[model samples]
Target chain A: MPEIRVVNFSKHFGKVRAVDNVSFDVKDGEFVALLGPSGCGKTTTLLTLAGIYKPTSGEIYFDDQLMNNVPPKYRNISMVFQNYALYPHMTVFENIAFPLKAKKMSKEEIEKKVLEVTKKLMIDKLLDRKPMQISGGQQQRVALARALVKEPAVLLFDEPLSNLDAKLRMMMRAEIKKLQSDLGITSVYVTHDQAEAMTMASRIAVFSMGKLVQYGTPDEIYNEPKNMFVAAFIGNPPMNFMENFKVQSKDGELFATRGDIMVKLPPKAKEVKFEKTEGLVLGFRPEHCKIAKKEVENSIPANVYVLEPLGRDLIVNLKVKGVGGESELIKIFAEPGMNFEIEEKVYIIPDPEKLHLFDPETEETIL
Target chain B: MAELRLNFFQRNSSKISQAVMIIILVLITSPILLGYAWLILRSFSVDMVHGFIPTKLTLKNWRFLWQEMKGYPNIWRTFLNTFWIALWVMILEALITSMGGYALSRYDFPGRTSMLRFILVLHAFPSISLMVAIYYVLKVIGLLDNLWGIILLKASLEIPWGTWVMKGFYDGIPWELEWAGLVDGYGRFEVWRKIVIPLVKPGIAVTAIFAFLSGWSEFVFINTFIFSQNAWTLSKYVKGIIGDFRFADYGLLTAVGLFYVIPTIVFFFFVNKYMIKLTIGGVKG
Candidate 1:
């Protein structure tokens, strides 16, 4: 198996920089997800790695062999597209055997390998059926079967589960994850779904505006986001931002506040340094903070605007009463069946360890 | 809107709508269907019976066409010549248009759009308009009045329109199919052959039949180019039946015309039988 590495890769289409200077290395047998929102250049990076689009500059190395001039056929990589891209004219047997037939293998060997793959994938009964004759989940399995029959050095997937319904998508997601690890093939999967990345990837490379913003493990990306975008993009309801806060220093300690209410800093705040005091934005995860009925220490008083019950927990959208009668909307995750009602006065106690701070101008994380 | 449509359909019985549709369809198609009926009747007539009525019935005209294969009276030689030309034209046109259409559809190069537009503009002017120029070019090349020359010329003239038709079919095929082939370790041309060409079977079928028919029924070029009896084709001899004074063998002419139309109908049926089933899974859902 060849380990795939991309260094300073950039792809430009006329004036648009579809993929800016980006670099990452996927170890053999590791599943890496290129996660981003729409138009975030994750797809471009995957396409470049697949040799579908040649990199405008920089170098791609598969096992330290420079691949700038390698065509996709010679790149020894297999891709499962989002739409499955099954050969509609061919039956499942023929579709799975296409790459083997391209190699000019013996007919007996081709049939044997196709049967083996179909049986392993539990799709042998569909051998005679065309793609349109099968269900969507079956078609996805056939696509995987086609990609696996070749036994390429590396694998690539472009939102392969995006076409399936919610239930099927989850089922396929687990199946693909298990299959990837079982095969131990270096794979780069491109998708925009946070939960898919969080659940399937060994490591995640989060992208934004054609740039690679953060490359880390799932825990590192979620718990130690490098910027506001990663922090906001990684979470489901997204991290709540308390922006335009005045940074105050007194008694040899730093505090961010809206003038009337006070804020608590994490214990390690002294180790994280930022000097710009005029414009600062504080962020904390919704699940990390809690709603208290009684007034609590280092808390902000707020009135609940809406309470959405999400089975196990409720999302309380609170309008915090700030200085000068200004309001900052905050979401707090609370246990369900608490009988929380709208317009109820409550206090938000944020955990200092889970708090994040950012510069208003750069929007990059300060700690 | 649903209630209004229901009320309207209830007020006007469906039988009236069906009857009106049948009447309109019959009125539109009666001319061609009646012509076929008259031709069949005339083919059985023994003499030049006029005024839309058959006087005497005989197979003598057909027997003459079938039996007289010797000397200058032979019709089979001219039929073979036309058939050979049509077959060659169909094969050559299909091959050239398929590759040319695929290249234009999949690749982008300098003047690509202009070239596609140019093909359209060139086809806009009928080949009949350039007959003199074509004849002079062929005469200079010393290929005029030759069967190969006619076949090549027909294929060339049909390429522009045929390319566009094939390109429209190729456009309907997703590019991911080719990409999958590429990932499967097939080269570019191999992908076109193994993936693309098979997927466009319907387009190829229709184009081949059209090219074959166009070459089969060609009259103006063969008439204008050919002079000697050795170069004579089916259409020329069919017209030759009517003499200079317009006094011609109507029964023999109708018999030959019926013979000429049979291949096209048979070929269409043959192509259609497979086209319907083959087109079923050629495109992705």
Candidate 2:
């Protein structure tokens, strides 16, 4: 059995399914991120794993022992809540020493352990202050120190950096990633931030509508998404979608085209026969598409609908018509300092190796 | 201060409302202050010729009031009775509200909303209306004319408002704080003891103070339920000083009245800060 195994787990709140048949395995010493938009069941899944919630149906196992009936504290896991949840009445040292005191440790032992953990987190100076009296960044460190003091088998983080500002979040992200690896603890982090998950997690599990849609390494999830949902959700600016595309052969050349946008089929796709099909959806990432100065082979024509400059890069929103006479917008990233007027016609040459094709009816990737 | 600061009274230099507010404040406070002044003056008067003002100070009234009063026990004996009753009421009130308010604030169950409403409804009918039923119940329980009976009644009546104040305070505490304790290996009871109780100390102080004062000043229930002079509280003792009205000592009565107000005044001064800031959520009358 893996360090943690959740098999066919489901939690239903009356008529609503909060986490539906979610299943995943976390290896020993692995940091897995549960990532999704709000209300997508990521946090619900994390809570279930923490034993804070009892799954309505399914099995949870820790180190091969059944855990569905285990209370949170007995499960030998610690969770750092999103709000930090430091006791307002307790000093910082007491907050970190709480678990030890609960275990009936001697006063000197509790104090020694608290000092050791606080020193490690560099929050030793804040031992006498209350949570509210400390900076947000310092509070984050204290929350982590408190959670780590118990040295539980697994660590759970519920968007612990969500309350921090962008600069502090970034700094704490690096700190948490380093601390987790140094301790070699099996950790499950819940966050809706794609950037955070992509940067810190050893593996990613993407959830939507109470279901785990994809679970794999960051590289695999980003480069080889299993479905349109995973493809569109994993990247910044998201993957562009051209629905109801059809492969057509005009004068002995097979091309996947919708309205004025056209891309010649690769050698492998050239052999497949096609009538105009509604199930076909073409997908590619914004960073994978390049602007062709002149007509490049297998290129598609699109108008630059709008240009948004984001420091190092300019996102060119392309407007193109589909086969059904419906217009669509696709984002394309251009090198910084490149300028294009609105409505400027630009040819987009999507990287053949990076293009994604999906069957809309099944919502599964075809290539 | 730099942003065109207004005096506390007005930002646009309006003075009419401010003037009216001062007038109303004096109008409301003058009676209470003047009556207190008259009581203090009469307590010191050596003779009726002083006519609401004391010309010469005397300790005879204080001495007689503290040492002897007809139809009641000594001041120390009555003080003990009142002290025990108020202490019991305060402890019971604090215990009931902490649990009741925690449940109301943190959980949802069948009839929770109605229960919250129903507790306040218990206060809707006048105590006089319920007195007959309460009297019979006490008769059946063999608690009539018992000091414990009065203590129970006062504390029970206070649970509704005390619970509401407690619930308001609990509303401000994050549920995550409780959850952290649970995850820290503390049981639910331990969590309340270690986490919830300490954080809600101010709310508890307000509840205890109100309960103590209500018990201390209770009149009707004590007057009806307590028939023995030995069982009399400070309120009954004060009433006893006015018994029969023949050769009444206005100075003695005033001295006792001032003494009766001292404990409350001193008690309020201790907890006044917390009482002012309590959320004391709006409970429907």
Candidate 3:
């Protein structure tokens, strides 16, 4: 296994910056994923790491050795492309044996390793079948097996599970995570799918518009986002933001207010020194916003706009009357048994400890 | 009943249009087909000097050709010369075009776009226009009347078009396959040989067939450059019979033409699938 460190790497396709001064480190045996939307440069970063595209600037190091000038073949890496890219002319056995053959291993040894990998992937029965003859899931397994059979220093995946169907993608995600853990090989997977990154990666590097937005553990990224972008990006339904919120200290008590809908600020808010801006954006996840029957001390009155049942939970969209002229809509996760009619008046009390406050101008978290 | 009658009439009119289309196709194709058939028939007729519709039929022409082969070795010499030239051209064309095409498809070198544009522009220049210049150049280089001269000229002439065709075929193959091979410890050339070349076999086959035919049937260059009878190709040999007014052996000429077409017909039969694949996958797709 090799520890890969990308140091100030940047790739420019003409004027378009595909990867912009991105740097990260993958510890030996670590499974890291580069996650972002399409055109967010995650795949480009992975391709650069694989040495498919030479960086426009900066250096990459494998362990202590500089690798910017090294060719891909000399880098001792294996890559599984998004399309699987199995040789259409070769059978599964041949595809898996290709790397070993390239290394000039004995035929008997190649066959033994091929059989071992195919068995581990449960694709031994498909050894003789071409890529087109196999199912998508089987093809994915073959791709993984081919990459693993080489026993390279680092394994790179470019959205390897993006082409599979949803159910199969889930299964393969778990399988890939398990495989990485079992082999203890350094792997870097690139995907636009947040759930895939959350489920499969030991650490996720979130990218946006060719910039590394955040790099942290899934739990840290989800629960304690550093910026408004991370807060909006990490959650499935996304976080709701209310602008022009003010924090005031009145009668030795802390309260955050937007018009008349004011709630007592958590103890942590007192520690933050607010800037001169009058408007602060209050952020809360859908799950943290609770629906209550009666107005409590910190509850805000809202009218239910739409009720969406999501099997075990309900997403209730509520429009709250604001201090400003217009009303703002927010989603609250309700219990499965809870039922509310459209346009019905209700009150919502956000969990203060879970509330995220951001500077409206910069969109960076205030606390 | 009236509606059903109208529907039947429409269906019959459609069938008649289809027949008319087939008749038009035949009308366009029959001249070439009939010409080939007449040549084959005349080759075997005893009185082919008059016309292809000979009153008497015999294998006199065939027997005379066989007799001449034994004494002069003309037929064998010409056949060997043409085959040798075509073989060299085929090998050179496939190797040069495949490598050039692969480079053009994969690499991002300086001046690549201008080079590709230059090649495309070169393709637009008719080969006939270059015949005189090529002949003079070959003579200056002491290659006149030499088999290698013709082979070299033919292979060079075929490269631009062949490279264009194969480059398009290479473009259709995903770069990821080569990338996978590269990351798996194969160098660029090894990736091309083991991954890229195998994927574009149909393109190479197409280039080979076209190159072979171009070299095989070329008359203007072969007839102009070759002065000696020994260095004469099949086309030059065939032209000789047509040139002599005193003994214009039409039957022998026809027989030789038929013999020459046999290889081409066999070649097309084997590579027709690849040709279709090239047009379908390389061009339209």
Candidate 4:
């Protein structure tokens, strides 16, 4: 396996910059994911890495060998498309054997290799079945078998589980992650699903609007996101933002204050220098906010708007008055047994140690 | 109840609509059905009364099947000529249009839009209006009265439509399949031949059918360009037998006309499924 290095890569379609000056590296035998929403340059970066699109500028290297001008066929990279892309006319065996046949492998070798991969993927019984005759999950396995049979230098996946049902997607996600690690092939997976990226990738590269916003491990991305985009994009129920809070120092202790709501800064946040005290946004994850029957230290009073029962946990949506004199809704996960009637007044406090502060102008994390 | 009476028609609406559909279909198809019946009857009978009554049954009208008529080549000679031209046009049109359509659909080059627009304009112009120019071109190329010339002319005329239809089918194939092939280490042409072509078999079948049927039934081009009796196709030969419309053998004309149409009818039956699917696919797409 070869380590993949991309240096200041950019791609433009006419005037639209699909991927802009993004740079990252995939260590040999490591599984990395390019994650973002639609048209966020994740797919574009993957295609460029696969040699489907030439870089508009900068260079790509596979262990110090420049790959900017290489064609896809010569790149020795295999991709599993989101649709699976198994040839509808060909049987599963034939589909798996396509790359081998292209390499001019002998018939016996091709059959042996195809059978071995199919057996591993648990699709040996489906060898004679065409793509249309098989189920979507079966087709997915066939596509994986095709990509694996050749033992490519790099295995690329383009949202390969997006076509499967929710249950099957989770199943395939675990299967693919295990398979990639077992084979120890350098791989780059592209996806918009945050759960898949968090569970499967050794490290995740989050993109937004054609720029690489943050590249870190799943825990790092979730717990210490570098910016507001990564913080919002990487979490479920998403990160909540209380915007336009002014930082004030009272008796040498900093507090983020907006209208009647005030929050004391934790000891860890005191070390960071704040260039602009005003227009700072306070960010916190839904799970980090605590609901209280009575006011606690640094707690903001809120009205219980609604309660969403989700099995073991309940999501409590609270309405609070903002600095602009408008009602803002914030959600926090509470125990399912907890109950609150609509329009009931309560106090919600954010975990001081886990709270995030961002500069509204730059959208970058200050703490 | 009064509501029950109102709901009665609504409940039986499906059955009523089915009955209405059958009646409409029969009414629309009865004239063509009667014409076909008359053609078959006239070809096998010696005479007829009131256009339906046959005076005598005989095999004389169909004698041209084995016997040579004056001023006409053998029936087999004309049939073979027509068959060869139609076959060539079918093959040539399918080949050229499939390749052209693939290029127009896949590749982005300068003048691609202009070329597509030009093809639409070419198809829009009636071939009849260009007969004078086509005649002079054929004469200049020394291919007048040649079956090859007619075959070339018919195939070229059908190309715009064939190319357009094939492009639509090609457009329906996902780009990821080609990308997979490329990533699988196959050259672009190899991917096209092994993957893309097989997927568009229905498009090729529809194009070939249209080309063959048009070439088989072509009259104006063959009548004006092909002058020799040896090179006469079934269409021109049938026209020759009806010269001046005086003293024409109505029975033989019917026999020959029915004979000329038999292959078309047979071919239609053989590929009817593709034709139906093509219409639905075209409309839905």
Best candidate, TM-score-wise?
4
The first chain of model 3 has a TM-score of 0.96
RMSD of 1: 3.0
Better of 1 and 3 by DockQ: 1
Model with the higher lDDT, candidate 2 or 4: 4
Model 4: docking quality category? medium
Please provide, for model 4 over B74-161, each residue's C-alpha lDDT reduced to its tens digit, 9 standing for 90 to 100: 9999999999999999999999999988999999999999989999999999999999999999999989999989999999999998
lDDT of each: 0.87, 0.85, 0.86, 0.92
Q: Per-residue lDDT of B1-285 in model 2, one digit per residue for the tens?
A: 577866765754467777788999999999888888898888877765546657788888888545665545888888889989999999999999989899899888899999888878876757877888999988999999999999898888888888987888888788788878888888778998999888888888888988999888999998888898889888987788777756567778888888888988999898887777665532211
lDDT of model 1, residue A70: 89
In candidate 4, what are the lDDT values of residues A1-367, reduced to their tens digit? 9999999999999999999999999999999999999999999899888898899999999998999988899999999999988888889999999999999999999999999999998999999988988898999999999999999999999999999999999999999999999999999999999999999999999999999999999999999999999999988899989888988888888898987788988888789988988989899999997889887879889999998888888899998888757988898997557789999999988888889999988989998
Show where candidate 1 strays beyond 4 Å. A250-253, A320-329, B1-12, B46-50, B67-73, B243-246, B273-285
In model 4, the runs with Cα more than 4 Å from the true position are: A335-337, B1-12, B282-285
**Can you tell me the DockQ of model 3?**
0.58
True contacts kept of each: 0.83, 0.76, 0.85, 0.90
Top model by DockQ, which number? 1
Looking at model 1, the pairs that clash are: none
| Residue range A131-169, candidate 3, lDDT tens digits | 989998898899999999989889999999888998998
Question: Which 10 consecutive residues of model 3 chain A have the lowest summed lDDT?
Answer: A269-278
